[model samples]
Target: MKKILVTGATGQLGSSVIETLLKKMIESQISIITRIEEKRVQFQAKGFNAFRASYDDVVSLENAMEGVDTVLLISSGDQGDRMQEHRNVIDTAKKTGVKHIAYTSRCLNNRNTLANKLMVEHFETEDYILSTGLKYTIFRNILYMDAIPQFIGGNIALERGIFLPAADGKVSFALRSEIGEAMANVLLSEEIENKIYNFTSDKAYSFYDIATALTDLSGKTVKYTSVETNVFEGMMKQRNLPEPVILKIVDFITDIKHNQEAGIFNDLEIILGRKPSGLKNGLKTLFGL
Candidate 1:
């Protein structure tokens, strides 16, 4: 079995990938990078070859990358210099003679208009990996259906209804867990090289559609109110949300209005071998209806 090292091993998507890989193959074939000693020990207990590494630290990355045949570079969070961290990972992968690399990027393929500043990192990372002379697969994942709770306030979502500045813009959302499972299959297949996939649901739905789904599932009258940007921000602030969190919520709504978040491609369905989860079912599951 080839040695496959996975970065972001403690994250939701990374954990899903690791779990699926362990089920499909032997533990010796999988390796995980985690800087936390407890997480490393937990993975070790599961018989995985867990290593200590951080994306920003080249020396640590080099130490963790030894004997890694393929590396899955799960993009780091938006905090700090994420683009530089990605560069370090790419450079280290090449230096350590890793044969194949896979990166999880955001939805949409156009470099025309980016959803946000951090999205630029995904596109730039794509360019950087293509320039590395290494075989690579890129998954341009869309908004996760699982993130609906966060997008709208999880606990008071039904009571609050949907209040965003995105207007009627539609989004193609898929569950992150299912996407992660499909990604694992792509990583293990050497045949899926040098390709970029748009990981999105088959249909695009607006917040209005989302509200309808929630209403049908929760038996509550959920309203979709497309307010002004400032109005939405003020609402969040009144709820005692921090500035950064308010900014993120506004950005997501703005991105949706700009058409950067909506996707119509079925690349994910092709990989999953079935229709991706629709809004009604996803909402039902999420809200425990």
Candidate 2:
């Protein structure tokens, strides 16, 4: 049987892709590269092929990719030097003579955008794959909406009949599961080739749209407050969040306020051969409303 290797198998995205793949093929043919030894028995019990590897360690990568025909590299979340880390995997895959490698990238490296910083690194990784003259596909995923959390004070406000933090900026949020399914389709479909696919839901919504949904479903007077970036970060710090994480959150919000652009809707539907799920549905799933 041809082997398909999935890197970062213990991660959220990697784990979902492997689950989807198993629905179509036996786990024996699905190889997972991960450093966590505790998951080895779990994968073994499920009949998956597992290998011990690390992106920072080239020898570990080469050994993992041995005899693997295809590789699905879920981007490393290690924001520090991610480009070089991804290069390590790409180089090892090439050395192992892998036929096709699929990379999880972002949509549109549109030079002037803040998303560009994130997008460009993925592009660099894409460039490395192309340089090797290897067959590849790119799954450019959008933001996942399921990861949102209610602010700490929002609980008291909800009890007091006041919902807060109505961000006015528009957001194009897609479910991670949808992206996972599309990645699996890309891996399995023969019709797709050396090309790039931008994965997003059909609708792009603003923060008010989310607020409106929350109010309608939860029957609570939830409010969306548009606060300055500094204020938001200060509040998070006051709540005892770590400085580094708070800074990342602040930077992310600043990006959203200034650079959250309208996203492409067709690529995801076309790839999956179905309509992508809507934000309302996602909200309902998350909030039980």
Candidate 3:
């Protein structure tokens, strides 16, 4: 009767976690809380106790955690008040006697990325989670390797070339799917206890490395050019991107340029029990080249 609950069950990361769990455990042991009725029904079809809940709604969260022994609090996607939402989930979990809590948090030590509001919010949530004294696992996830296309503009990469404001910044990017599977394993392990884990690739890759990888994979000469921050901003603005989204993208590039995500950690290997693939392989899978 070991019940495990997964929040953000509809998102890419959450879906990965839930998908892996289904392979390892019975459906009765898993419950997914999502606000989308369509997604709720979809998960329900998979034999999960799929139901609706919101981070802002503590009552629903409490109900979701009624018999849940372990809960994975996927960081809320809300831009308005992510920290408060996280607090609500954590508080509700505690009140409902949920024993172990696992959270996907940002790299707290990355100074440059803190300029982004979401990064600051993640820090706040992490602090609150620790303060609550809940048996917790903090996964300080690095940039997802699967996100390279999104981050570096994959559409423009093969056609025009790679252009960004990142100045010699390298990241130990990881695969989101792999991370989700590893996290599921952590949730299932009886021996794993309260700990903070940094999930990342075994090595770091810079933008130049990305360009080279794409070139090799696609049989095209993709080039990386470091432009001024203003120039990059101007380009994004021309694309009719919203002001907030443009600013968020700029902050992400800046963080990479500052080498904020350049650490290779073995913590992921400990949970996964294997070395994650390098950048080129990830790029190939992402671009289908």
Candidate 4:
């Protein structure tokens, strides 16, 4: 059996991708590479093969990818030194002679905005992956609708109903399950090598629409308050959010709301061969409504 290894299996996207792959492929043929042993155990209990690995450690990565047919490098969440971390994984995969390499990247490759960090990293990653002369697929994932609950919970805790710096800009946020299926399709298919798959929902919506969705789902009068970037930063500070983190986050939000770069794509539906889940269905599952 050919083994397909997934790095960062503890993360939301990675875990979902692994589950989707195993459901389609044999359990023994799917592997999870993670830094945490507990997470590995969870995969083992689910009848998956797990390997302890990290992006920073080249040797561990090589060992994890050893004899594996395909690899899905879920981009690291670490802000600092992430590029080097990704490079290490790519180099290790090359050395291990993996058949196909797939990466989860940002929605757009334009570097004209602050929300383009992932885009930059992904472009670099794609370049490096191609340089290795291996069969590769780049999944340029859009914003996830799974983030709604977290944003809503934070707003409620801060007593700031639908608080954000974004104005009328729409984000092409995709459902986790939809992305999972698309990734699985790419991983399982042998015909898509040397392809760049831009995975996003067919539609886009502003945060105000998000707030309205919440209100409609739970009957909570959540108001969309578009504050100035500085004002939003101050609000986060008032809520005792860490200074450095809030500064970066506020700047990202400012870019989106200011129309620096924001829109939707039909890539998800194209890849999955079906209509991707929308914001309402995503919220329904998230809120259990």
How far off is residue 255 in model 2, in Å? 2.3
Q: Which prediction has more favorable TM-score, 3 or 4?
A: 3
Off by over 4 Å in 2: 108-111, 115-119, 150-167, 259-261
lDDT (10s digit) by residue, model 2, range 128-182: 8889888889887876776544432433534444222335545577888888888
Superposed by TM-score, candidate 3 places the C-alpha of residue 256 at a distance from the truth, in angstroms, of 0.8
Worst 10 contiguous positions by lDDT, candidate 1: 109-118
Candidates' lDDT values, in order?
0.86, 0.74, 0.86, 0.76
Deviation in Å, model 2, residue 267 alpha carbon: 1.8
Candidate 2 vs candidate 3: the lDDT winner is 3
lDDT of 3 by residue, 212-280 (tens): 999998999999999999999999999899998999999888877877788888988888899887889
Per-residue lDDT tens digits for candidate 4, residues 109-184, read: 2655556354566677778888988888888877778876665454362244776778786777888778978898
The regions of model 1 sitting more than 4 angstroms off are none
* Root-mean-square deviation per candidate: 1.4, 2.7, 1.4, 2.3
Error of 3 at 161 (Å): 0.7
Clash pairs of candidate 2? Answer: 163-223, 165-224, 165-225, 166-224, 166-225
